[model samples]
Target: MIDAAWLNPVIAFSIGILLSFKLRKISARVQSRRGPLIWLPDRWHDINRSKVLQPLYDIIKLFSKQTIIPSTATPFFIAGPILALMCAVLATLFVPVAGISFDYSFSLVVLFYLLMGEILFIIMGGISSASLFSAIGGVREIDLMLANEIPFILGTFALAITFDTLSIQQMMGFNILINPFAALAVLLSIIVKLHIKPFDIPEADTEIVNGLTTEYGGKLLGVLETARIIMVFVLIALFVDLFLWIPSSGALAWVIFLAGVIATGVLIGFMNSLFARFRIDQATRWLFKIPLLVSVLAIGWAVLWRYVL
Candidate 1:
């Protein structure tokens, strides 16, 4: 029998993977023609006749590509992407996917630690590429992180305050019932955090020819792409837990949660496609100035709701 602990991670990963694929399918369908076949047609058959495996199949194809590194790239460049992917994957272990806390002793602190490492890995990968575009991209990432770190930390602290614990599992227990500004701030921050378009100035394809990833190709690109998708899933899960009370177990709850997440992704993807990329300075200034203030106000309101209400 599979251990319950192990089973939760599998379930969470599967959910994340499925949602990612579904978003891609939805995007393709929206863009105009039918996409590829769903991986499990029989399962969804007799229900909604829709394809859902394009994202997963695309990811698999990426991983199977021949590994190649530019001759001018640093020796460490080849391994950097894998390191980044590993850091993201490890983060999933710390997150309480199905609501069961495991290894509770370290689960709370481990997530922040892993997130820091993931950030470092990304910066390192960019720098180690030894290309000018990559170097500039690395610098841009550092700047972006610096600009947004305050709001991100404050928002996270707000969650900790709500739960009165640093543990992610404990944080999940606290529902976000107060302050629309806080939710909006965090929602916007997540978009910026993911560097989605309008905020994806650092990796501007028109200017830098792929920016930090300009030198990476083949399997390394695959690793980076997987890390990006996985992080997207993780962020959405965090939002769901923070904003809504997820049911312990039931078909309806699962469906509701899935729909909520897909809604978030669609909103984000639409924003990405519709908006033009911002200049780096403009993006940083805008996020830190207005959104940060809104987030602070949201927290203040939440505090009032807790005490004055």
Candidate 2:
């Protein structure tokens, strides 16, 4: 537990940065683009960054730029990303990544709350920007969050009811085998939560400019992007922990866990390349429809198997 206090955030940040770069490369490959260069660069120019370090470089570049705060914006424009980044890294500590984590009852609940906080703060950043575009993006995000979180919770809790435990560590197993409906519901929710395509309503640049971060730049934008990178690490790791968990320990376990993460990222990248964006209403409706129904049904089924039958 004590070790997790320092190690978890360090792991999340370090690996999160690399995973962010790799995921971009994955997307680029799916689209048949060359992506970022793999070797260390000769000049560190923006146009041709080293594949492994490009995302980190982008963050540094953003940090070095001028930070502008609009007169209409509130202090939350400054506070939101910092809070959101804190929430993301904190959430990572609750998840078992290659057996390094802090575990106790209801960590799953805590994790969900933290992720919700992350989203809320991002929305706060947008709304505080005082741009109509940001407001519209915030509203769209609210809609997607409302529509997606219900199914996410339903699927997760259904598994909890089946396992009769609230601790994520206690809940580990081949969960997808036992509860495919819950699995599907959660996967769909993950796509929306990660803001992947087809469901990427809020950040649909074609419609809402840069969406939530439309009014942000410099260090603030860098902080927000850092938060996003951490989240990408956390959510995929959470799914692996919950649904495809390994029973081993030590170096081998770490290897398997990382392999799972990369595989999942690749899966998401393909989704990003293949699907077109969904309109806000369409996105919300899709979540509210089959995914929500399946989640509710999964919960009922789990209860029936666990308690009634």
Name the lDDT value of residue 210 in candidate 2.
81
Q: lDDT value for candidate 1?
A: 0.69
lDDT, model 2: 0.87
Top lDDT prediction, candidate number: 2
lDDT of model 2 at residue 71? Answer: 98
Q: List the residue pairs that clash in candidate 2.
A: none
Q: 218-283, model 2: which lDDT tens digit per residue?
A: 999999989988888888888888888777888888888888887887788788889888888888
> What shift in Å separates residue 167 of candidate 2 from its native position after superposition?
0.6
Stretches of candidate 1 above 4 Å error?
1-3, 7-13, 25-51, 101-109, 250-253, 306-309
lDDT (0-100) at residue 260 of candidate 1?
Answer: 64
Candidate 2: where are CA atoms >4 Å away? 40-49
Model 2 TM-score is 0.94
TM-score of 1: 0.83
